[model samples]
Target: MAKNASKGASRIRVGVGGWTYEPWRNNFYPAGWPHARELEYAAGKLTAIEINGTYYSTQKPASFAKWRDDTPDDFVFSMKASRYSTNRRELATAGESIERFIGSGISELGKKLGPIVWQFMPTKRFEPEDFEAFLALLPHRVDGLALRHVVDVRHPSFKVPEFIALLRQYKTGVVYADTDEYPSFADITSDLVYARLMRSQADVDTGYGASSLDRWAQAAKTWAAGGEPADAPRVTSTPAPDTPRDVFIYFISGAKERAPAAALALLQRLL
Candidate 1:
């Protein structure tokens, strides 16, 4: 979650994975900017932000409230369920950890809370029963608020129709990572599209060149229209709906400082 941009009847957001990085001061942030205003500054540039602080540990209610109050009313935050829940040895037994994360002031974001990203470890392969059990533990609602979940299964072994089917069964999205290092699954299992743009190059001024950003913008449109892109990587041969769907896109990791530029470029192309 970062900033939410709307074009016509579509909901498409372009942003980076997280804020508060030092490299951004020289690139994305203004020189000599106050550290406390980083989120405020970044929110003005992008449509949304994926909150990385929650991934490392549970954040306080005050932090969540402050974040919501600082950004624009339309700005959103997609948060990763803590590492303690996803990076554990037993995937099926993380209910308490998941509960702790869900209970910890997430409702403070209110309507601005986007999807809850559950990023599995790369070493974790497809164990259908075990995985389903873990998915079952994810709450559909927290404090009467709806929760959207996106699963980031990194292992190549997860590239199967069954895996996509399972996510569809639970209405959980599968992350589409546009990088060679991670598994690329573009199936639209849920009502929303979650993409992690991890291939930004540091050599270029914009993390991704103009042509690449154009293609991504087009893909975002396809996803927004509830259709799949012809050129996108697929986990299943099936197609998604032909109705409008919400889309959340992130320029994450690689060439970290240049990610904001890539995201903004994509946003501009969408506009």
Candidate 2:
């Protein structure tokens, strides 16, 4: 069962990228489990889910409402913003695409909505002015609901301190991608902490080893409590203010089949 932190502590939510995976049927899901009820079952085990389909195509408002209703009241979903807004040569020209994606009825998720992740391609270099323009295009509210935005910048160009400063200026969070394949950095620029743990091993029963899960649990708690992990790699040495911040950690993109086990293991540790 999921456990809540002490009263007044910031929440640390652990989950996987998406709920529908064929491999999960043999392991994570019960035998003969129906496909339509996968989200309901997954939500009962994990605290959050990173909705990836929206990145590929727009979803109907009914779909969002269905997702919201299927999950537990406290469950949250972090959606990946459409690629049309991020995968481009000129970031400044993505305003219309951004508006369209937001206006596509994402607010139907209502209180269940978490952060909207704007992910860029690995080749997309960080151009400060253009990147700032793109960030400025992100609206703070849509349909009377507040929105939180985070960027997943994969290019090595984003490793510079200037990139962290830009994120801070816009109050946008930077996704701390925990992987050797991408540019990973831990810098607190917003009120929330987002991390995508992408190094799950298929050979391990829990994706990551028990010791690794323990360490990650500690890191997640530290982040939620408003202190940076001493072992976290960072782009800047400057410290973030000591204030409680909500934390979201998703087991993503490694051995996809083991993501649910990894998330469940992490949630057990958090509890």
Candidate 3:
């Protein structure tokens, strides 16, 4: 739900979380640009953008269609499911709410719909049975198009093997959180990989230091080639899947002023 976005190979998608930032006007976007053209302009720059707006409210079908059309042919958008589904007292009681979120004209995005990020609160403890039931509620498809689901658990207790095993059982990937405030687990469970980097420095042109980007670039290559960085955090002690992973990395809106530049800088290295 926070702002960010990139690295590695053809399966990689690099970009920010949202595009309608007022600070981005003179910083990332060109000065005096039209307000309505923000999505159109930002879409062209990043290969993908996480639909953070959807996390707050349900968007109309027309709006979804417009967003799909505004981006380039290969552009992908990962949406965050509504908090109403996850913030409830019990995770098992979210079936109808999750269904409502999926039925909210998300199909209008068609193939442009990438993955759905289900982020949990930092206080949301990892309950094996309840969490597994919640995962079961995730539909594999909506309107005949298959979906990819990624979970972002912020609780420090999620750094357990059982949680990772449960995610692997559901074929769900875990978000590789690169922030001190969240639990940063880098375990790979699905064909896709999701990462949100938040340690951007406003003074740095690329948001990240040169060495950090280099390490990320290398780690991305490892991920794309079906491997992992030796230094990355992990909950599962077992090995990663043998197949290649589609990587999605982002330099999120931490040091907000330089996010886009960081994404572009990382994407440039990959390209």
Each model's TM-score, in the order given?
0.96, 0.98, 0.95
Any idea what lDDT model 3 has?
A: 0.86
Q: Compared with the true structure, what per-residue lDDT tens digits does model 2 show for residues 1-271?
A: 3454323757888899989999999689999999999999999988899999999999999999999999989889999999999999999999999999999989999999999999999999989999999999999999999999999999998999999998999999999999999989799999999999999998998999999999999998898888999989999999999999999999998898999999988888876
TM-score, structure 3 vs. true: 0.95
TM-score computed on alpha carbons, candidate 1:
0.96
Among residues 3 or more apart in sequence or in different chains, the pairs in candidate 2 whose N, CA or C atoms overlap within 3 Å are none
Q: Write model 1 residue lDDT over 30-58, tens digit each, in one string.
A: 88999999999999989999998888987
Q: lDDT per residue, candidate 3, 1-271, as tens digits?
A: 1112222333777888888888799778899989899999888888888989888898999999999999888788998999899987799999999999999999999999998999888899988999999999999999999999999898888889999999889999899989998889889888888999999998898899888888887887778878988999887779886677788887786897788898888877775
Report, for every candidate in turn, its global Cα lDDT versus the true structure. Answer: 0.89, 0.92, 0.86
Model 1 lDDT on a 0 to 1 scale = 0.89
Better of 1 and 2 by lDDT: 2
Give Cα distance to truth, residue 33, candidate 3, Å: 1.2
Q: For model 1, which pairs clash?
A: 1-49, 1-78, 2-47, 2-48, 2-49, 3-47, 3-48, 4-47
